[model samples]
Target: MKKGIRRFGGYKFCFVAAVLAGIAFVIPAAWAEDGVTDSEVVIGQCAALEGPAAGLGTGMNVGMKACLDEVNAKGGVNGRKIKFIASNDGYEPDKTVDCTLNMIENEKVFALAGYVGTPTAKAALPIVQEMKVPLVGLYTGAGLLRNPVSRYIINIRASYDDETEALVERIVSDLGIKDIAVFYQDDSFGLAGLSGTEKALKKRGLKLAGMGTFARNTEAVKGGLASIMAAKPGAVVMVGPYKPIAAFVKEAKAAGFNPVLATISFVGTENLIKESGDAANGIIISQVVPSPDDTSIPVVRDFQAALKKSFPNEAPSYGRLEGYVTARVLATALEKAGAALTREGLIDAIESMSNADIGGMSVSFSKDNHQGLNKVYMTQVGGGKAKPVAKVARP
Candidate 1:
């Protein structure tokens, strides 16, 4: 009887010790090192949180925060909490590279997510490729990020080609405007958008009526606007950032060129409506995501609720949608990456996903193709709101 009691006690003690060991194994490691083990997963982002495009940075930052916070509240991903360390690059390529390198080297983040800008994000591609870190959902329209086959980067939004082509098609088919002109920034972004516009026009047996290119950070777009206006095109398409877009519109309006305006997804028509006052009326632009003003859409409603609950003081904006989608994609990849969460595992998991849908829009990815959202939405400014006219188009 004594021997049997001792045996039973020993068995119970061993079982309790094994259970404790199992709990320790399941707990993820904190963000003290590069890879997140069985406590937290650290993701890094280098966004334009300050500088000229601070509004965009703020929106995206808020979206990412809302998403990660929600995830943390819900017990995190794979029994590990997500910690995002987002830095402001001030829209400078040098600063972007520095911040990204620091995140990878010092912060020891598992992957790079929601990086902002074309020039800045492009600058860090070499290092990301060299280090083999998963560069997912870069916030840029430059085709090179997903094209010409870079192994590291994945794009969350549609390319400029998709938006530009859709706008050009509408100009030719729907609006029936023959003499079209283009005002583009004189960089990779400008060239890529112009290329798409040219291709679309060429299909309709039409050519550019006039063209003007401006350097980045130069508000002297009046000269370009004048050049485009001189052709007296029935329609004009602009490919530039918000500051330049606003400057062009204001200058063009001042010059009395009231031709129908069409632009890529980055036009920020709502913000422009507020800034330009009455001048923004009747301006049409493309959108890859749902409009904030449209509360009927389920995704927009959910997003609004998320924004309202998480960030009450701030209003939901376009860039915030970008960041929200960015977080969603990363979360999907992390969920699918399984228990052994490494950078390589994440890359493989994301690359394997095809036709991945996040609420309203759908994204596709493959081993050879990294461009996620290839669909574009065409929207027009009417009655003090951006109204989506047509369904999404994929290229």
Candidate 2:
């Protein structure tokens, strides 16, 4: 049966008797004159809510709530209520493709939002293009999302190349470290970060001191740790998820080799801090989202308040901020796309984005550019918390 929009739930009026005379069983609600009915405006997302990258997914879910709650409180966009449908793809490429298909075909979502993982998101790219659904706020540093197939994808975070350049520049310029080593997983993600580091180093007349590879499933990373330690460099950069991060930290500390450990946003920093405790202190990582630890900021304060109200026991993390940013950017685009919120209208709205700040950072998009954020900020882990080190800037 089609649910009708009533004032409260009393069924005070008998207007339905007049409307029910028509052939169609479901009559449009009176408030839905502009096409935004009381049913729902559906949106979908797929993330690694299970498996290794689950922390990231959980965080994004929290942020998604923040956005939706805020939107619903204020009459929603175009009088349509936002209904978000999210699923877990287990951080696997093949699983992501299937999950995305289900979201599109079964759920009939208006667009894709807060999709996480580079490899996982990449698996669904062809479907996004084929179905003409807008993929918004993809949480990864992979450049493939922006290059070649930039039209359908709206990237909100800085790319791996941007983070790599900042990390390498800091290692070479500020730290005065020449012998830099890199340890990464043997996959497309690691390869992409490696390529960015190499390209950035080329501008400074230097090369990688050592390179080590580990499989994504490698829980015992002693071999990779030993390989990276053998280089005896002043700093070592890593491009892998949280499991290896903890393993490498434990093994490297045990080996009495504590080189400056830096990583792209993908090291699952929140999980590392939770597992490693004090060991996570002093470790540096790049971030594309605002620091949740810094609660003094107004945006962070409001986010915390909303999060506490909705999910009091749940802890805020990197993925939460990422998810919030994704929704904020998409809603901003939709607002600019006008009352007719179609996929093409969204693309055009995003393409015309300019100087719009979300909380702390300014996000912009252009006709030929879809990279929403170009600056990357450095963060240091200390006292079991991730703190922003320097202001975001062009790398």
Candidate 3:
């Protein structure tokens, strides 16, 4: 899969813990492959800060450190100043290969941002392609890291074949329903949402009325609620994380085996409605980004007035607004990678962002696409919260 490291696989780091909560300060290595200087630049993450997907690694490190503290309070990006660092691979892939080789051979970090899981990013995908670095904003779409397209992995969101083709077009044309089933999470991010809902149900000629699994950070969802309630499928979907799909939707509605569950936005939406309280209400998720309470979209109203003036009551979510639009698309590819940054000029300035508009949704990447955003919104789960799904399909 593109040169070596098998594109994305293999994990064998023996020990290496201690980073999250300890924060980072290490800057020893000066043979900088490109985390720059003349101010700062270093980046790093290695997610899952302490177990059962610590709320998707502290809501993607509090939205990538509150958008890198609002781009170092506006004096950064292009002028540098980014440091970051984080580590705790509690989502574990051999401790995310020793926290990506101690943040690229000992805190040298030039790039790699907002990482979450997909078997802890397939063990840091052969160490970010043998130290070439530049893995921005990845939270896992897992087609072996956007299908062999690892120039340094910059994927934004939307994939799992664009959230299972917008969740099979609103579960077969606005919930008309098709005996769907699939409980997932046995690996590779629930077999890539069970191969994107079996290729969006074989493009509608339909399929998959049953399939189940579990085993990842285990709550051991009773054999996926006895193989999706012995194929009683009227709709199931769920694919992993969020404490085994909120313990397989609270043991499939206390063994009554309800349906129309649906999921994926890599689960964890408010940790599956605060751990399936009312069995996470009506379920159904599938966003890429946008609608952290819409906020009329101006970058989710500047991510809800800077996350309520920096966490003062922090609530706007969708995992910290997709980590504040992946740190505003990594500060717009390090301010278009000028100021002489490297790591292949921030992966050619995020593959020369073609669609670019980061205020009300729009992000692109090229060199034949690194999947910045294919779109896909769709949300649900009433009173317990998590809105959105009205006209849906935003991409």
Candidate 4:
């Protein structure tokens, strides 16, 4: 009887030990990493997916998904498929905050990517900082995102200062136009562009010939147009979304007030053409990404192929091409991070890149610098399309 009791006690002890061992092993696996699993990595985006600026957000999302889908088809990055979650903020700052919070806190995204506008980015930046989430490839060139260089934020495009400086140089050198005015949305985005234009003009010992402002997300540009018209400036630098800018252009043209109209890359080229019709012709636009139709460049060719394979019916645009480049860069960083897949590891991998060539475009990042791709291409709208231009001439 004592022998039987000893055998039973030994069995119970072994069972308890086995259970404890199993729990110990499961704990580490359960808490391996946030937004990362054995099979997948999750990314998030908050942008104006619907509204006047919907074209920018939707185009970017489509491009990113296309790249990610292609990567997944080819066994993914280091054996993990990327899952992208996009939330719409309608280009509104308040909605951007909500979308960003929901993505970080609820969706548990590993990183944020392809965010659209300057005001929206400003709104969500505090949350990103507080949560210490890495935000990659914002579309805005606002200096606020690039100035202090937060460790958690990464920019894949040129700055507004860069674009503005290029515009000023071309306008002054090629067109010999010194009487320049600004028509901009009255928000952080507009102010950022305004500041950039101001700095660029000041470098040449010049100032704005005139300035006009309109409310954000609205087509109420008549008053601003009147203000700009009153100044009778030779060239006008416009900073706003497609809708208001289109309205301003149509109204100004109707009033027979035609001058050199130039805008930054943030203005969706295709959408602006669609909205402005013939009025868009001869308008100058600065582009951060090469023309999607320019398949000569290796990266542009790859983007075209990926876009065609993934989205057969969708046409490529600068916004979508930018998105594709952003995803490719992020994917390269993710692959460099290896299978460990931690946020910090990913950041380190990105910072380690030195003039890394992703297809054709050269992108570089470091501990001191987070902005990549300083080159800006200039395009002119003609025959309902924006094409690369060597110089800016009078309309």
Candidate 5:
């Protein structure tokens, strides 16, 4: 059954009906899980599809589709096709809660993947814990996500702590940069990077020369730019989406302030360049995933081929690579779960992976350690796109 869109609080949400629909069902030889019938296993996602962070959602969806298409064409994992349903949260915390509940209570998803932003994930965490739903490959490095130990969440990327630690060390050592300033989005996502940068700088017996903040979901960068430029630090670590980051860069360049600027992966790299135009030159960015253009790794080539096959017109990007990696990890776990394929079995299979190598990258997970990837890569804008520089030395 095709789902209809209904207006809610001046926003039209079209995923609600299809999320709860069960059609063309077949019975398994034995029982499995709530989402896993004989023919399909449903997965849910809550992403920012209609807001400042919309690009990230759309790009990830495309990559996920490519991976799924390949898997389903091969008869899927144990003959069960994968069904993905996504809802838009507009990058709002409150809406994240609503979408999460609808996915779990109404849609009965086996797991959730590619939930974007720290604030949105923060809002949805407690509910995930309460309901015991698996959360895989969320695109944030908030301290809360890595701390206090939630059994339901499996993190695929390096934490902001890891990224910031590596970045600060590189700036202090290789670039001989001091008097560093920080510009961040004013939310959990921003705070996570801020806290990481602070801790990393503290280890070197130094503190931030300056700090500035911008509101979530808005590209108001006048205040943040002015405050950071006032300090005149050798470099600044930006923590926000691409629009605000780009606005800050463009405005700061116009005002004749072009210091060494670096940003975390949450700041959509492609969008930043497009929005900032020529002003994006010489900017630094830390990435958790490898470049999609690097064909040396088999995974990169696979991702490029899948992207072209699934979305011939769309270009390969960091966002799509992240999504492709997440879907690949989930698919691997599902294969290990056997024909039974219970949610518990899936979790167990993932946890049991010991130093699993995925295309030149190492991933490991255990009952105690839920983090899969510990590596972070750095890139700098040389021409029109971000080019890989080197790997950040882990602290």
Candidate 6:
């Protein structure tokens, strides 16, 4: 009888241990999906934080953190605070891939946000797809990110195609200028803008008067300048970051080859102005967001307040404002996803935002459409400041 009782007790103990072990395995799997925890969600950013394009990345990070901090201060979304981690890629494609891999494999981020450049974003896309991680609000409007619409990538700004269309329209219609030329970086980002320009000009029964190219992350605009100068275009559509574009503008002005200079929104306006000094004056720039100085817009007002609260010394900028807007859109989707957050749930929530009003901006998404805002605004540099251009005229 004693031997039989001991055997029964041992059997029961083994069964209970097995059950507890199974529960232990299931609990972690249920809670730790990607970077989610009971009280926090982790998001990562890989951008040019320490190079010539550092302004773009740092501004975006500041804006995103400001908005996230505001959300967390208000008790977070669905009782979970967002913990953002940013890594620098120096706007290099190879570094971007490495940073993205680390973020997903090591840091285990829930999603990626505020990526800086087109080339960088292009490099990270394959990894994003393979890992099934969502990338929201990248800072490029390249057609590749929008066309065919990857389930893992979300864009918040108007496409380069859209911005270039607006620019070409104004260059031809408002300015009544023809014989347009292009000065672009010799890379994915510049090529995307060049393609957009070609498409827009083709619609108007016109072709590029001249074309010139420069390598990425370097200010080698002399060769490109000479090529475009020879064409003597009435208006030149410059494509690249602020530093290179600024260098080109200054060199062109110094050489007395000034034409009506115009650029897409990717050329950070304030930084361009600073880099080119007075040379930036009379230059036209397409803007994806409203003038950061325009506080009349409800979203602008909120962005300004949030920025001041979080980054006390920082001033308003288009790049930072875009980051703020992207964060707001992402937060809205998180709220819609509810407490049981998963990667698919977050993506579904983002798609469900159809004509959704984020403060004053209208963002829309669907299963077939992932690009959010399509509106483009025009601005011009004058007196070292970028002001809204209500009317376009030949300079």
Error of 4 at 123 (Å): 1.0
Q: Write the per-residue lDDT of candidate 2 for residues 78-182, one digit (tens) a residue.
A: 766778888998878777887877787678777888877777777888777756678888878898888864688888889999999999988777777778888
For all candidates in order, the CA lDDT equals 0.76, 0.76, 0.79, 0.90, 0.84, 0.89
Tens-digit per-residue lDDT, 158-272, candidate 5: 9999999888877888788877899999988999999999999999999998999999989898998899988989889999999889989988888999778889998888988
TM-scores, one per candidate:
0.87, 0.86, 0.34, 0.92, 0.90, 0.93
Q: How does candidate 1 score on lDDT?
A: 0.76
Q: Which numbered prediction scores highest in TM-score against the true structure?
A: 6
Question: How many clashes show up per model?
Answer: 5, 3, 2, 0, 0, 0
Is candidate 2 or 6 superior in TM-score?
Answer: 6
Model 6 lDDT tens row, 124-236? 88778756799999999999998889999999999999999999999899878878999999999999999999999999999989999999999999999999988889999
Candidate 3: the clashing residue pairs are: 375-395, 376-395
Cand. 6 Cα-lDDT? 0.89
Better of 4 and 5 by lDDT: 4
RMSD of each: 12.2, 9.1, 16.9, 10.5, 6.3, 9.6
Question: Model 2, 264: alpha-carbon shift in Å?
Answer: 1.7
lDDT of 1 by residue, 143-173 (tens): 8786786878888788887887888887777
Clashes of 3: 2
Instruction: Record all residue pairs in model 2 with backbone atoms less than 3 Å apart, i.e. clashing.
Output: 59-319, 59-320, 60-319
Question: On a 0 to 1 TM-score scale, where does candidate 1 land against the true structure?
Answer: 0.87
- Measured with C-alpha atoms, the lDDT of residue 45 in candidate 1 is 84
Residue-level lDDT for 382 in candidate 5: 67
- Segments of candidate 2 deviating more than 4 angstroms: 1-39, 295-298, 391-395
